[model samples]
Target: MRRRNQVRQSVAVSAALLAALFVLPLLVVAPFRTALFGRETPVDETEGQPFVSGQLDGESALRVLDGETVLEMDLGEYLLGVVRAEMPASFHPEALKAQAVAARTYTLYKLQTGGNHGDAADICTNPTCCQAYIGEERARANWGENAGAYEKKIEEAVAGTDGQVILYGGVPILAVFHSSSAGLTRAAGEVW
Candidate 1:
């Protein structure tokens, strides 16, 4: 009986030590992980007022290149396509709004700096080159039954922050964004 009790206690201690080996690393890293990748609270500048359209009424149209063709479209209309393609419509309205602003700012920056396509167009539909774009028909097809609702959400997002752009030193900033990062965020100079 004494030998059996000693074996049981030794087994229990071994089990506990194995559990700690697995759990301790998680406990130590959790705080650092949260600090590195915490969610940022977005600021609401609209003061809870409902979004009103027509804010982009007087803006110049955008010249977008689609493959071999150059298409002219209203700035807001183009942003609708960009936002829809760049972000999931299921995202929160505020997130969609932020995407719209970022797309608009990026477009404006490209215009000011003379885009890589030379005189062909202001921007391209290819996401690798510029922002992604999806026509209403294609977007609706992709959304299937949720087409109308999703399009309406994207439209509201674009119209809600119409004409808004991120600026630095009184000029529109690049406002670049990516869906994911490789462990750490890299600066423009580092990537470019």
Candidate 2:
């Protein structure tokens, strides 16, 4: 029937338009997002950064949950806060431990390399962020502990200090996008 054909055409057009609205913008935006994050991806590649800006980065900012402003926490503080005091017994202890280590390690790299002082605006970093931005070749070389071996030919960056870190500004050793199999935030000291 003509009605059926019209319906099919309507659905087809709707799908086409939806694809354009969604996929077209992504095509334009994804590379831009990578550039902003100090990374790049070919269209042929499957992986990519989803959002561009540091402020409205959506799930990327979820690591700093309920955070309207930045918090500066060092590794010693983080270790004492998250690892020594606050981890939950319900979670897989190894995974949680790994996250804690990653969070502390990455924070140090960020603080040392992002700038020499605490006054600059926060950089775009999260668990999924590339290791190059943290500006540490040492983190790449320390894969047994840092776990950045998957990264190929990491970009070189200047190391400014031995005590580089802040809770949100630091980089994580294990760089998966999602948080964990148990889905929980670390205790206040761990991340704050």
Best candidate, TM-score: 1
How far off is model 2, as Cα RMSD?
20.2
Score residue 98 of candidate 1 by CA lDDT. Answer: 96
TM-score of 2: 0.24
RMSD of each: 12.7, 20.2
Number of backbone collisions per candidate, in order?
Answer: 0, 9
Off by over 4 Å in 1: 1-53
Per-residue accuracy of model 1 over 1-192 as CA lDDT, tens digit each: 999999999999999999999999999988899676786434333323332345562366777899999998778878888998999999999999999999989989998999988877888999999999998767777777676778889888898887888999989998889987778897778898
Could you tell me the lDDT of residue 152 within candidate 1?
Answer: 82
Q: Candidate 1: which pairs clash?
A: none
